[model samples]
Target: MKTTFVSLALFLAVVAQMVASMAVITNPVSSTKGKGGKKLSVVWNDDGKSPKISDWGGVNVFLAVGSQNVQYKLQQLGSNLPVTQTKGSWKVDPSIGANSKSYFIRMEGTKLGSDGNPPMAFSARFELSNMSGQFNSTVQNAANGKEGAAPSSSTTGSSGSSSTSSASSSSTSSTGLSGAASSSKSSSASSSSSTTSGVAPIYLNSALVTVGAIAAGVAAFV
Candidate 1:
């Protein structure tokens, strides 16, 4: 009985440790932060455990709005990256503002891990308040997806959620127009039915009565 209890305890401890392990972000901790237009290192843990991320098929890194929630979406800073390399380079665009304490960095893996899901890592909140200079189109395009990231086509052209809003408006207008047209057609059909089925019979009866009156006058004269 004692041996069985010890074995069960060991098994439970092993499972808990595996559940706790995940890709770790070393930088952009409260101490490290982003500087617009200036190159920075994006680092992750390579603890040499089973299912090391370094062996994954590919990885991607992107910025997020909040530490917990998704925001602006922007685009991927890196794409189809080699997980074997636990580090990559990224430069924030000056045009894209980030000064708050709510932003985050995330690394996404293409291969599954011990948990049967792709590996992912998230950085604590970091600041990019002091941008180095004016906007850099080349770097911005890469991250924002114009060049290829295309994180979300919606994210690509973030301006004017107007495009999305317009699409919705047009759909509503189409529905309204179709309903009006159907109603007009229905009204026209009802009017035509009334004329053909109700008024025509009354006119025909009047004509027959006039013919009988004319015949009676002719016979009386004879």
Candidate 2:
């Protein structure tokens, strides 16, 4: 009986360890930049043992901004970053102003393995930023296909939230515009069904966040 109990305990411990090791958190890389930049941070526990992040040792982490081919290899934590690091600067041409339609940012990351090679695995469509320098992007409700129903926060932009207020206003305007433009309206039944079916859909990142006031001013010329 004693042997059996010890074995069970060990098994449980192993399972718990695995779960903890597999844990992952992809958050917005924080800095003094007043938002609106394509820069973000990626931190993870590459090892199964959870040590205070300061002791995580040197691990090569690769960050890919959205769909762009540009990959900035980050070797250290926030402190290790250059003192004059270009904070909150988007990958696009700095010449594009806040009004320019091409401003945007996306989230992507990879983890290094014990083999000391490039990323062995990668993250999925985690977060998207409008790069409006105001963080306002429409998020489709995950439960339905509808846009702009989820509540968000300015602080949560790094945690997979678009500018919530902006999203709401934009959603309302989009719905109104679509309704007005529909000359051959469908029957109420069909319309209701479609609306219901499109309730909460996965939001997409199509907008861009302009850099801080300085870069934004420059974007106007680019």
Candidate 3:
């Protein structure tokens, strides 16, 4: 009976620790300054660098404010060039050139064809505003099962013959907790399932916890 009691106590303690760890992993806080001098606090997964894909299917990421378009090429501004392949919180600062009232960002993912040409397979757009203190990205929101508009191509005047894509299909705007919260949750789950190396630590930790629980139960019975 004494052994059983000790085993049960150990099991409970392990369970408590597992719960605490999960809570910390799922909720992360980050803060960044907007170009307009506003401070924004965001909760994200902090999954490290953006993903890289095949050169044939390379992705283009950009931020636009009015006529100014800022392009981020892999490893530029902390993006790992191939952002379309990874599923996690990828940090990006949308500021480019002078401060602006609003920012529009987009991602274009392409796939190479048999004819040696690449065509767009996926595209997304996001809009950020200083007044709202929140950002709304079409792909991020849609991954959480929310309905939004699709991305479209646009031309920027300031960026000399550079074409910019915008995702302005949805009429609705999202608030902080509503849009971003869903994004974090969905992205974390996706990251855990999609890539083996990306979420290896999280999976290992969870497995250890589960194994410990099973051992404790078996020991109690013995």
Q: Which candidate number maximizes TM-score?
A: 1
| lDDT per residue as tens, model 1, 130-167 | 54221122223322333221221101000000001111
The TM-score measured for candidate 2 stands at 0.22
> What would the TM-score be for candidate 1 when compared with the true structure?
0.46
- Which one wins on lDDT? 1
lDDT string, candidate 2, 83-188, tens digits: 1222332232111112222212222122222222111112222233332211122221221113212111111011111111121221111222110110122234
* 1-222 per-residue lDDT for model 3 (tens digits): 011111333334433323322111111111123333333222212122112234325543333222111121111121234533433334443221222222333223344333222221111112333331222343333222232121222211100112223332322221111011111112333232211011100000111121111121110000
Q: Which has the better lDDT: candidate 1, or candidate 2?
A: 1
- Residue 87's lDDT within candidate 3 is 32
Instruction: After the best TM-score superposition of candidate 1, give how far the Cα of residue 52 lies from its true spot, in angstroms.
Output: 1.6
> Candidate 2 vs candidate 3: which has greater TM-score?
3
- What 10-residue stretch in candidate 3 is worst by lDDT? 195-204
Clashes of each: 1, 25, 2
TM-score of each: 0.46, 0.22, 0.23
